[model samples]
Target chain A: MDLNLTILGCHSATPRANAFPTSQYLEINNRHFLIDCGEGTQRQMRKYKIGFSKINHIFISHLHGDHFFGLIGLISTFGILNREKPLHIYGPKGIKEVTILQLKLSKSWTKYDIIFHELSSKESEVIFEDEKVTVKTIPLDHRVYTNGFLFTEKPKLKKLHIEKIKQYDEIEKCDYNNLKSGKDFKLSSGEIIPNNQLTLEPDTPKSFAFCSDTSYKPDIVPIIKDVDVLYHEATFLKDREDLCEKTKHSTAEQAASIADQANAGKLIIGHYSSRYKDIAEFKKEAETVFSNVELAEAGKRYSINSYPIEILN
Target chain B: MDLNLTILGCHSATPRANAFPTSQYLEINNRHFLIDCGEGTQRQMRKYKIGFSKINHIFISHLHGDHFFGLIGLISTFGILNREKPLHIYGPKGIKEVTILQLKLSKSWTKYDIIFHELSSKESEVIFEDEKVTVKTIPLDHRVYTNGFLFTEKPKLKKLHIEKIKQYDEIEKCDYNNLKSGKDFKLSSGEIIPNNQLTLEPDTPKSFAFCSDTSYKPDIVPIIKDVDVLYHEATFLKDREDLCEKTKHSTAEQAASIADQANAGKLIIGHYSSRYKDIAEFKKEAETVFSNVELAEAGKRYSINSYPIEILN
Candidate 1:
């Protein structure tokens, strides 16, 4: 299975005319998720032609204004659109209080239920799970209580080998599920037919990790190891590495190092400080540590197998 | 002597890629004030090159999401920019609670002081006053406790009649103040020179009223009478006049009627619904009731004397 990650916004700090704050749209195993909705995210979503109605779940990294300032606005929009489906939001503990308070004040309460899964754990744990995907928190080191998320597609159901199954009339349609589950079928004569011959292996599940506004924490490598795509914040360059410590953010080189150490399939670095005029320099510096690195730009869609970014006009 | 009004955003309901919500940047008497900061206001400000730093005062008309969703984001950006000037915000009663709750959760406290002037009056009252201008509330008929803002420039000091002043060498710089204040100057010879002889007439003070998302309420005519410029919400066309009472929004014709009754110098109608494919139709509809009607567009500026809109490139 393939995973599609669309960058709605990737700029750091405040939102400018040209640069937007952090926000992204992700699709994995037919499930859509919104990550880190900063200010102007709704406009970006509209600009990129993202079917915002598809997103039922949102994963927020932190409570920082740049990361989640757009949450209330989006929620208010949902209310105006008369959305009836429940929206599940996962974020820091204070998210619920702040969001509810704004809705209370605006009196723009939505008919749809807003299910909040407040996060407080400092350790990695499964936060969302369904038949198609499982989402885990990647506890991050930031100024505020923050958590990155690991979205992993669940193993798909094995496909039926029609040719092999058709050869044996004894194997009824009811027995197809057992064979797909890797269970051997027993014929009427007591002879067992191996499930491998009747079923084809499904595609491998894909995983993506989103980590932004955090220090260079190498301990997260194990949890995100072998992820198909890794989105890490590279707020500064190697020349400004000292500022990273004080700001609790990572440099381009530092983000690349984490990608190299984790052995990730591909690294997507963004959340760049406005100080650097050229963002291409970030990729150049990151390449020194990790060869497979992609620069994140707003409206660019990154599909793991397709290395080139697909930009929305 | 002139009022420059820039439409930051002028669409109704939720923000879209082509349309923004209600927000405007007004410059009167050298004072910059932001009115109704809807979502993406900061981005619009940056796009229009509006000096956001000059906005020491913000006036929110209502607590609707489209009216003030961007307040927190703007506040946060000010904090990031390290603004030290005290910011003044005037809005509905619950604004202070909602804004404070968000800041508390994000911990993005500004070093500068935020003075909130919450309003709950049902009648027109002066909410803000300075030596140069005074801001008053225009009680409106909306779904919520909403109040529109009226900004009026204070009377300026009289200009000195250079030829007359030079003729009387006894009138020192000290006597100039008294003459400018419309007081007769008494010379050392015990002769009084009338103030009219020493000073010329000053330009007439201008006033602008911003009324958004209100039903056709003729009662507000007296409050905004003779204003140099008036911005009123025309969320629907005359075709949807029946919806006005229920939605508490005005049609283009209705907005024009109010402006016509108030004897306003000019009328700018906006907050158009997305249902209308062509906003030009709104202008055509409004022209039936009022002659001087300007269609509001984001980034387009209206300076009363200029008559024509100065669109930012």
Candidate 2:
């Protein structure tokens, strides 16, 4: 399974020249999941060559315009292009009303089915699960009802047993399928064959966590602990600590501090202020606390394998 | 007065790699006015080096996502930048609701005052005006309640009478300013200098009309008649006439026919379909009917002066 995450947008409430708002595309087990579609996100996705047809599920962290403004456009484009596949969207309660109102006003109703999962309260709820992965929610502290998402790969199956299977002529033929199915079987040689003898250990399950537009809170630590990749909002620098406090946002140092406390394998910071001409200051500030700090630039990709996260800068 | 029009986005509903959606920057008399802010419009404005601070008024044709998706992000950016100037927006009735709902959900209120003039009917009405130009709506046939805008320049002041101002002490001392201001004076010879003697005729006012997302309709001719430049949507080629009719859009030949009927001096076609690989087909199709046909490409500029419209291809 190739687990890759592409950063479509990395800015905060404000959009800058070269940077986009908050949006990301996660690919795992040949399935595409979109997280936080901000304004101009579809164009960014088009620029990055992400196929629109591949995106079936969308998870929105909150109702901030930077997180979901592009949803309407992407939805409308899907309608214009006459898509027939259903699109599943999970977000806060107000998202349905906003999306519905736009469609009603424009009289541009979609042809495909759109299933909306409106989340209202804070809970560690299991939202989605497939054969390869399971997703949950991590509560976040923000001015609004914000939450983060935790995607954890499911554990691999146990290996099969191979020894002592050739001794039986009648029983071995009958129970050979059971041995290959990772079951301990009684052979004709009067020996018990363990299920772990045939195959090696399965690969480790990789995980990714997305935390958006929130203040520094330690509550999410347990839910996102030791994740392979963690994307946290770093809206301001250390110098603008007062502004960060005033706006209920986190500075780069604070985001890095949370990543350190959560014991995250890699820390990816985004949602920068437009005032900063160069973002080197943010990486420098975060690297003081976290060793593996990657600035989440728009259009950049970060890969999370079983080994370690590598950034395509 | 400096009158320059920059095509920020030129493609129609279907998006392409290089061409953008429908958006244009109209610069006249040192003021910038944006027409139809499509998706990725802010980035397009930046690419053309149009100062965002100079834009004061925004006119939206309809509630289509491609026409106004970038508006919320642009407004949010203005708030983040702490802009003090007010932004005036003119659109259909639903626009205000959409904008206000997004702001409420994000919990991010704008710092500057925003004025919305919502249009409810298809009647032509003046939406914005300054010293040099006025913007009025020209209703058209579309799938939605869409309308086009006609930007006509106000007539220039009469030229100064420089010849008869040789002896008047108070008026002649001020040079050409006195004559252009239409100030009259009595000469030392006991004869009044008439205003008509030393002045030639003032030049004609230059105008530009923008018609977006409209089908073939001859009724729009009177509203945009005799304009210096006309930008009409040519969403399809001549071969796809039935598709244009079914989709409620216009083909290149239909757009050229409208320009011919309106007697516009220059015809600039845009809002192209993404299906066409080469845009030369559009120009060729339109030029067969209208001689002065030009294709509107992104980053292209059309300068409007007393002379003919000059396109910087």
Candidate 3:
């Protein structure tokens, strides 16, 4: 299974000359999930060729425009393309009202049915679960009601051991089915062989956590502990910690401290404040505490397999 | 008064590589009126550097996604910027549903109130009338219940008689004022002066008609008669007349026929079908009947004050 994330946008509240606002495309087991659709996201997706048809489920982190402005346009595009499949949206409480009003004023009624799961509480809950993955909300502290997402991959079947091939040759025909079902193998001499003797257990499932546009809150460590890849908001540097506190945002150091406390495998930071011209300082500050720190760039994709998170093209 | 139009996007359905769905920016006096905001319109506006904040009212042609997808994102931007002024939107019946749903899901409620004027009937009534201009709906025939818009500038003041300035300074001032107000002037020596003798009549009000994504309907001749500028849909060439009929679209020849019947000053045809790579044929076919025909290109601005719609920088 290929699990990866593509960064569509990474700017904060104000869109800069070259930077875009918050948006990310997460692909896990052939399914695509959109996170935080800021303004102009559809164009960015088009430029990057992220097919809108592939994205059926969308999750918005908060009520900020920089986080979810592009959602309505994306949904409208689906309508124009005559999409018949139902689109599911998970976000804060008022998103449905805003989308309905715009559609009403424009005289556009969607051809497809839209299902919305509005978030009102500040507690962790299992929001979406399927055969491949399960997603849970991580409560966050911000100006508005916001929540992060934790994506955990489901464990797969174990692989057959090659060393025990000859011993089970007599019952190999039936052993193939029995081994896959975790059953014991019976030989022609009436000797029983354990399933563990012929097969090895599958590796542990990998996980990723996304904490978008939230202030520094250590309370989320329990929910995001030991994630393989953790994406956290580093809106400001330590030098601007006062501004971070005033605006209810997280500094680079604060984000790094959270990753360290959670003991996550790797940390990825984004959503820089517009005040900073260069974001090198953010990475430098984050790396001081967390050794495996990666800065997010637009159009970059990170794939998570059995190995470490590898940045793809 | 300055009257001009900027073609932001012009296509029929979903946005393609070179063909963007319907959207046009109209400028009269100093205010900007956005018409038909298709998906990715905000990106187009930003790329072309059209002053977005100048737009106070938006008029959607219909509820089709290609017509008004960009509105929600634009409104969210206004909220993010903390704009205090309210925005007025005029369109068909279903627009409010789309907007309200998005707002409800994102939880980013708008700080500014949005006024929606929904149209369900095909009446040719004045929708908006201000000091400088008046906007009216021109009922149209299409696959959906759609209506075109007519923007007409108020008649300009009479030109000052520069040559007769020094001869009668006392009577000239009053004569010019009376001429501007469409009245006859009297001399101080008890002599009556004819309105035409002192000054010429004011220029007629310049009018622009927007006929988008509709079939060739000659029923609107009276509503758009003698318009100074007419923007009509030319979705296909002459050979694809059958396709135009089936799709409820207009060919280049058909769009020009409407301009000919309306006695319009000029015809600007756009919304080219994606099949045709060379759009010069559209202009060539339109020019066969309408002498003053121009092809509407994206990012090109057409000024109405000038006789021919000059492309602005």
Candidate 4:
């Protein structure tokens, strides 16, 4: 299974000369999903060469302008492109009303169906699921209602041991399907062959958690514990801890602490404040607590199974 | 008095790799106004180095997504920037409802006052007027309720003839103000000097008319007759006249015809459809009917007082 995450934009409040607000693209198990579209998300997607038609599912964390202001523009573009596939949008309550009103006023209805899944649960719940992966919500503490998303791949089938299977003459080629499904094979001699002896254990499922625009709260650590990769918002530096608390945002040190508490395999920090000109400081501050820390830059692709890959500027 | 127009984005329907939707910045008598903010307008403004604080008023032609989808994002950015000056928005009815609802849902109210001047008139009416300029709406024919805007500069004060004024010692420095106001001066010998002899005539009040997303309607010619510059939408070519008629859009020939009938000093054509790759064809088609024709390219600036100046790419 391949799990790739691409950073679209990572600035905090507003888009500036070289910085944009929060938005990302996650491709897990060949499924494409867009996360948190900011003001110029469509243009950013174009810049990154992300196909518009591939993203059928969009997850919006909150109603903040920096998070979802580009949604209407993207939707309108989809309409103009004459997309026929149904688009599914998952967001908090009131998102439907806001989007519908704009469409109504513009009188630009899409030919494709737009399905809205309004989420208002305080507890974590599964929002999307398929045979290959599952997506769940992570309720967070914020000035307004907000929710994070966690994507986890399903368990893989057992790998067949070719040499061990060849040792048994009675084990026919047709029995390989049963062996891979973790079932014992019955030999022609009326003897049972254990499944473990014929197959090797499969690789562990990979999981990724995305938490943004949330205050530092330890309660979410358990929900995202032991994830392969965790992306958390670090909107401020340690010197502005007071400002962070008042704005319901987290500092780089706080984000690192959450990753440390969760015991994540790797940590990616983003949503940097526009005031901070040097983004390398965020990685430096996060590395104090989390050993594996990476700064999320636009157009960079990070893989959960492999190390990060930086695209040429 | 200087009247300058900058093209921020000039494509129609959708934004593409090298094309953007409709957006323009107009500066008249030192006052700046934004016309038809499409998606990515703010970024385009930044790319052209247009100051955000300089735009105190924004005009929306209609409720189409390509025209006003960027308004909400621009407004939210103003809030984040901590703008204190009041911002005024003028558009057709239902625009206020759409903008206010999104702001309410996000709970991101601007610190600055946002005064919405909702317009829903079938006849031409003055929507905005100050000492320097006046803006009026030109009713247009479109699929939806739409209106074009006409910006006209107020008559400027007469220029003082310093050499001629110095000839008469009786003309005190304080009395020069009255002479500039088009009032004649009387000497002590009962000799009266006419205002025209003492001062040259002021530059003719410059005007600019913006018409877009509408079919060819000659009714607006009288409203914008003899304007310094006229920007009309040329969404299709002559070959796609059927498509233009069905979509309520205009061809290059039709737009030029309107400019020729209105007797505009200069005609600028924009809003090219994405299908047309070579924009020079639009200028070619329009020039067949009107000689003074220019293509509206992004980042290009057109001065009403002088000929068009092409900025190097």
Ranking according to DockQ, highest score first? 1, 4, 2, 3
Instruction: Flag regions of model 3 displaced more than 4 Å.
Output: A14-19, A79-86, A93-115, A161-168, A171-186, A190-203, A238-247, A273-275, A306-308, B16-19, B94-113, B167-204, B236-247, B272-292
Q: In model 2, which regions exceed 4 Å deviation? A: A159-182, A186-191, B14-16, B161-164, B167-170, B173-178, B181-185
DockQ of each: 0.81, 0.64, 0.33, 0.68
Runs of candidate 1 with Cα error greater than 4 angstroms are A169-175, A186-191, A305-313, B167-174, B184-193, B305-313
- Model 3, C-alpha of B139: deviation from truth (Å): 1.5
- TM-score values for chain B across all models: 0.95, 0.94, 0.90, 0.96
The per-residue C-alpha lDDT of model 2 at residue A293 equals: 94
Number of the top DockQ candidate = 1
lDDT of 1 by residue, B8-34 (tens): 999998889879999999999888999
Window of ten residues with lowest summed lDDT in model 3 chain B:
B165-174
Lowest lDDT 10-mer window, candidate 2 chain A?
Answer: A159-168
Q: Score candidate 2 by TM-score against the native.
A: 0.93
Global lDDT of each model? Answer: 0.90, 0.83, 0.82, 0.90
Residue A239's lDDT within candidate 1 is: 97
How does the DockQ of candidate 1 come out?
0.81
The best candidate by lDDT is 1
Residue-by-residue lDDT tens digits, candidate 3, A10-37: 9887554367789999988677899888
Residues B1-313, candidate 3: write the lDDT tens digits.
4888989888666565556678898988666899998866776787778776788899987776678766777787678778878889998887776676666655658888999988887878789888888999988777777889999887677765666545565664544566766566666787765655556666667888999878999999999999989999999998999988887899999999999999999899988877788899999999987888988888888887766566675
